[model samples]
Target: TGESDATVTNVIVASHYMNYGGYDNLKIASSTPYPAIGIKMGVCEGDSTLISILNKGMDAISQKEKSDIMNKWITVQYEHGVDMKKVSRIAIISASVVLFIFGSFYYWNRKLKKEVSRRKEAEDQLRNSFDEITEQKKIIEHKSEEVMDSIKYAKRLQEAILPPTSLIDEKIEKNFVLYLPKDIVAGDFYWMESTVCKESNNELNFIAAADCTGHGVPGAMVSVVCSNALNQAVLQHKLCEPGEILDKTTDLVVERFERSKEEVKDGMDIGMVSIEKISDTQSKIKFAGAHNNLWVISERDDIGATSNKYELESVSKSLFEIKANKQPVGKYEMRKPFVTTELLLEKGERLYLYSDGYADQFGGENGKKFKTKNFKNLILNSIDKDLNAQKEVLLTNFNDWKGSYEQLDDVCVIGIEI
Candidate 1:
């Protein structure tokens, strides 16, 4: 076979023939300068090459361009929804101003209301407190008046029960009585009566001072009962001796109350004396007491003066051992029977009788008591003074010692000079 250059040339001739026919026909039909196939074929192959080049040149682009693209995508949707810069700023400013005004007004209004409420509560509390205090004051005044009235009535009764001062004076040469009450009605009472003793062939004159169990109304009532019983014992019962008198009074008091009733322990502490004068220099004294004793003040001539000045009168200590009845004039379960004592008084001797009240009373700057020792000293110091002046001295001393404190007990003192 021959080298076939003829066959290759024939094939080329057929491709050129096809191209020319299509190209000429499209040119003629479209009336464009180039065939559509030419442009399409060139573009498809060139676009693929351009895409590969763009991917390779990515690192060469500026950062601004990359950032702009990213921001554009994020804000793209909100841009059309609102005009944020202009309209939003106006709305926010208006709302904040309205809220500030409302909050300030509300705070001031609440503060004013709280102040008004607090003032009203204070006024109400003050009014209620004043009312309570007024009511209590009225109650106290009423109670005080009642106590005073009771005391006044009891005092009158006590005065009527006591005998005249003349009766006591007739028995002793010179005498004095000092009586003080803790309240309006005293717990202590004094008595005087006349009697005759057949055994010693003597006409006896007697005086008595006594302290009842309690003070105030309770004590006053007991005093009334005791006073009545004592009179009856002397006059009606005819019990002359002090011991017999006390025994009779005790039986009467016990019998006055019922057996089934609640028992009351109310009785008296007493100092009783019978005085009779034989001459100007000689006299007789008989005494009895319940848990109490007496003292004697006498002038001694044995002591002399020094430096031409009269010596101070000596103060001697002597106890009047009155036979005390072991028993109280009441139905006490634990009481011993009373006993009587008799004594004869010489000239220039004095006898004293007193109750525990004055000694027990609280006084002094330190709130201490005007005790027995001080009382004795006072009596001795005032030996030259008259009975009335001596009494005044005692009262002054008591008041001075008492200072500003209230009297705690009733006070009583009796003195007799033979």
Candidate 2:
């Protein structure tokens, strides 16, 4: 093929020519047998002498020589060669591809396993936190129940110390007490006691409306101390005059508080009245107060003429106010003896003694205080009604004024008709 100066050539050749003895220098790409021919030679039809000469030469060749020629030309030999460097390169590349696939799979599997573990841990922590919160809620509810129970028991004790309704009804024929506590136990209380005067032998009924320093438990405790002091002053000391009784009461309360090592600054604001009936049409009243007031409603022209200390405001024609001292019934920087106010009460007149809770309540459309002025107007309008009806009217007005607002403090109002 190189002798023809051809770079590449394809030709149909005899199968015998592919071996080493025939065309040994040529690289035979492929070979196929020609089935139509064996060992035949072609010649011209007019070449009789050449044909006779080729036939005679072929007959002269020996069998051994022909066998050797056939063996040399037709026998197969190893010709195709292998490239070791290319085979090694293919082997390394295939190994590297398999290793990469396995490595990626391993990395993803480990990542998925870690994610599942983290989620499980988070779920466990959440469950633990929920359990702790539920336990704390239960504890808080139990403590609250205990506190409520104690407050209810304290209410019972507080009720025991107050004057019974039956006693008030028996002593004062026409009377109504409006008592409302902001909490379970209130600091506001109404008290009454009956005693006969030593000199005049006149029957005296002493009644009081008191408001302590605060409301609820602390106020109730102070009320207990103060109520005991009042009882001691009236029963033990035999004090009849309203001013003397308050003076003795202040001494007793101060002495009782002094026994405590800690400084006790609790006290009460009280309005007390002692009523003595003289006749069917007339009665006498002596009142004393500490930061509380007495209100007398009458149709008589001389309502405040008997008492020099009474105030008659033009806002209400039938209302008279006996203002209390500007100090409480406890420790004060400018303490003085409480004043006793004397007045004459007719058969059809009414008396009101109360704490500041009613006037101090915050409500109405403007969410303002039910001020003293408005309270006086309400009382003046309701003066013509009976004691029971007046109580109902007061209650209704208080509720209406309060509306959705919470009661500010303990409220106590006492009314009496002579």
Candidate 3:
């Protein structure tokens, strides 16, 4: 390092730091003893306040930490080899030393000025470069916002396509749709349609909760496709059975996506239910699903239905979970026909169709998923309350379960009183 130091003529850069290291002796004369280096931090005569503040800050550090830092620089075997008298004489001739120190400081200041000038020029160039970068960043951000705006407009269109609130309220006497999108738009969608069977002239109320393969834009696109397929199956094809609609929807979605040259495998999992009122007090319900399940909650009390929510809250309720087909709506290796399960339900029973979003959400005290079993329990517990109160309780429980965690997926829960 000394050889490297000797190679350079003016070593101002090393002058600041070289003194921090312990050395045997500092020799600046022609007859030298060792390398010459020194480092000292000081304030001017009028800077008592600055020194006091610095000391106060330094006092916060532990004594051991400060000692360790000091010992690293001041070696245990350090010997300046100068007595007090000589140093006192050097102080007595303070005027001459001050002149020399001032001259050296002036020389260093000149060097510092040249450095500052060079750095100023570099900073000007860097500032220009940063300005260009900032401008480009702003442009990129604007374009991104515009893209998001377009997507938001697309979300509005998607919202329009969903089963209207009026329609659901009209078809089902008491219903609650708990729909939450992970983003501005969602892949999980709920749809309901009221139709009359051509054969028997019976009114069929069809409802479905579907979860697409993805979320956000891509999933929403697939949802749109699947929803259209459902529409075609009911309105165009006149197919009312849950199984028939599922079959037609799967076919249409697969056909549409496969139309592209790249083999696309986009699909969805759906739980569909068709309800037809057989009598004033009874109804026939057909259910089908693809990787989704259906839940039915019996009335808390069959006694005279009360208008108040708290009146029925104390009554006990039971839940029934029906498993679905293992296959998805899209292409699968072992594809089988979607089977429809037919059931008869009494008045005051509630039917629940939902995506896996709620159950699969990651949250809780231990940060675990709210699995399907627990979700069924939640539905069963809330079944005693009125439909609107049930919605409030479910959302409150979900929020409590999901403390500060993000919603993992799109959630859609549809409950209808039979």
Which candidate has the top score in lDDT?
A: 2
Which one wins on TM-score?
Answer: 2
Q: Candidate 1 on 1-418: residue-level lDDT in tens?
A: 7332222122223344435444222111112244333101123545877766665665566788766744543222111335667677877887788777787778877887888888888888888888988998899889888877777987887778877677667665588888888887877888777777767667777777888889877887888888888889888876678767777777777777546378776788887777766777866666667766655554443211111112233644333333355656677778666666665567767777888887877877678887877776678778778787888888888878877889887777888878
lDDT of 3 by residue, 1-418 (tens): 4433232322233332445543324322222345655534688888999988877878888989877876665433323446679889887799788989999999999999999999999999999999999999999999999999989998998998898888889888889999989999999999888899776689999999999989999999989999999999899998988988898988898899888999888899999999899998888888899988777766443322211222223447656666688999987779888988887788988788999899999898899999977887777766668989999998998899988999999999999897
lDDT of 2 by residue, 95-174 (tens): 89888888888988898889889888988998998899899899999999999999899999889889899999998899
**How far does residue 402 in candidate 2 sit from its true spot (Å)?**
1.5
Each candidate: RMSD to true structure?
A: 18.5, 11.6, 27.2
User: What's the ranking of the predictions by TM-score, best on top?
Assistant: 2, 3, 1
Question: Residue 84: error of model 1 in Å?
Answer: 10
User: Candidate 3: misplaced stretches above 4 Å?
Assistant: 1-107, 299-315
Clashing pairs in 2: none
Off by over 4 Å in 1: 1-143, 164-167, 170-173, 198-202, 257-260, 299-313, 316-327
Models sorted by lDDT, best on top: 2, 3, 1
| lDDT of every predicted structure (CA atoms) | 0.69, 0.84, 0.82
Error of 1 at 86 (Å): 9.8
Model 2 RMSD vs true structure: 11.6
lDDT assessment of candidate 1: 0.69
